[model samples]
Target: MNDLSRGLAYTFATGLLWGGVGVFYSKGTEKKESFYGFMFLSALLFFLLTWIFAFPQGAPVREVLLVAALMFPAGLSGQLGFWTMKKALEHGPHGIGWCIVQSSMICPFLAGVLFFGDSPSAGRIAGMSLIAASLLPLSAQGVPAVREDSCSGRFLLLIFAAFLLVGLQQTLSLVPSQCPTLSAAALSWRVPLVSLVGLGWLGPVLFRKTGVRCGEIGWISLLYALLVFLGQLGIYRAIDFLGKARSSGTAYPAACGMSILFFFVYCFFKRRERLSRRALAGIGLSMAGMFLLAIS
Candidate 1:
């Protein structure tokens, strides 16, 4: 298949995998303890396994520590956002939850410009416009009523925060590609592992133990870890085939958009949430903005 086709295919597959993530996270809520507990344990195990292969033979302790340190922020933000997202999903409409959670992308883009001096282009401008267009309606008025027990206002904040974290993660993406000495996989694993371990240390001291004891929860966590790993693999593969432009612009968002749409459709069909006329408009605009952002 051609580069475009391969990128498109990867995007679609990524969406499907993410769709499964929503379902899995929702199921996880039924378990007993806090979402972070499960996240921590699962992350720890995954990191342990990844480290076994990821740590180079006889690598310097200092270098290993440095890689681990890099992971701290990424993992903490991600897991925290995830826990918040899961809670929100349980109480909110799945479609809406997914849609809002992605607002995290905006922050990183802005950060890129500020920190890395990455300038925007016409396509980037148009794509960002589209994404912004999609959000206008959603934010114009009050959202549809969410469950009292669900994520609601706090959850929305978490989603926004999560997107920012994702943006930072994106900026960090330059490290591996630019450095060339550290492989992407090694960087990827280290980043997350650091964050998780940091959170595992901090979570309990700050808050009550939110441990969930459900056996099924373990399964969901495993699936989440695996999907994330696979998604990263797909990203690299797309980059190899399509280069950065296609991979970042068309490929990543296309996949993410489809994933977002899938949740929206599922929520609509299930009658879990009503898509306001405003939301529809916002979604369109958001897509435009995303396209603009990517190409820019």
Candidate 2:
């Protein structure tokens, strides 16, 4: 397959993996799992799986530590944003609440254009526009889930914060690729660093016995972590093939759009999720947007 096809394939897998994360997270919620504890544990899993091979050879300790330190803050910002998104879901309205998490993607796309020297084409622009616009139905959801007869300040703040942080996360994820030494060891250097921070955050929870048992959702969390690892791999590869701007403009949104379709099928058809016609229309628009993106 060509670069575009491979990139598209990787991007599609990225979406399914991300959707897997939501599935496990939903399971954790059902089990009343501690959010911080679960996330830390999952990050540890990703770290171990990715870095275990590199360590058996006894690589340079100082260099390894340096790489880990660089990635820590970037990963932490994303971790915090992820938790904040969960809070938004719990306290705020449904459509707009979740919409913010997905919509924060605009930051990376904008960054690509402004800083990364990415030039947008008509198809790319229109495709991204549709993908973003598809979420309007949810963002406009006012009555049942939201309070104050409108989208609340807290919810909007959480969304904006999440957008900035996740966008930063995406931008930082590209750092390793920009350096030749780190590029070849992208996952080796990056996952360990992020996981180091996760372990530190989880240390107290584990040592102090926070009463957050991972027994039931433990397998699911592991699955989620693996999917996350794979998704990151896919994103890096997609960026290699398409550049940051095209990767963000086409691949990231395409995966998100596909993931939404997967949820719509499972929730609306099989599980009887409370999906409205308007939401269904929005999902269809997103899928169409993905098609446009792929061929653009």
Top lDDT prediction, candidate number: 2
lDDT of 1 by residue, 1-296 (tens): 67656755676677667666665555555564546665665565556545554443444555555556555655555556666666556555555666666554555445434554444566765675576456556644424665664455766665566555555554444333333355444544443454245336336524875555546466777776666655655654543343333333344454556556666666666646777777777766655654444334
Model 2 misplaced stretches (Cα beyond 4 Å): 53-70, 93-96, 142-152, 178-183, 186-188, 203-209, 244-249, 269-271
Q: Please give each candidate's TM-score.
A: 0.69, 0.81
Q: Which lDDT tens digits does candidate 2 get at residues 2-85?
A: 777887888888888766666666555444436556776787787787676433233466655555655777788787777677
Local error of candidate 1 at residue 175 (angstroms): 3.5
Q: Say which candidate scores most in TM-score.
A: 2
lDDT for model 2 comes to 0.65
Clashes of each: 35, 1
What C-alpha lDDT, on a 0 to 100 scale, does residue 44 get in candidate 1?
Answer: 57
| Model 2: ten consecutive residues of lowest lDDT | 141-150
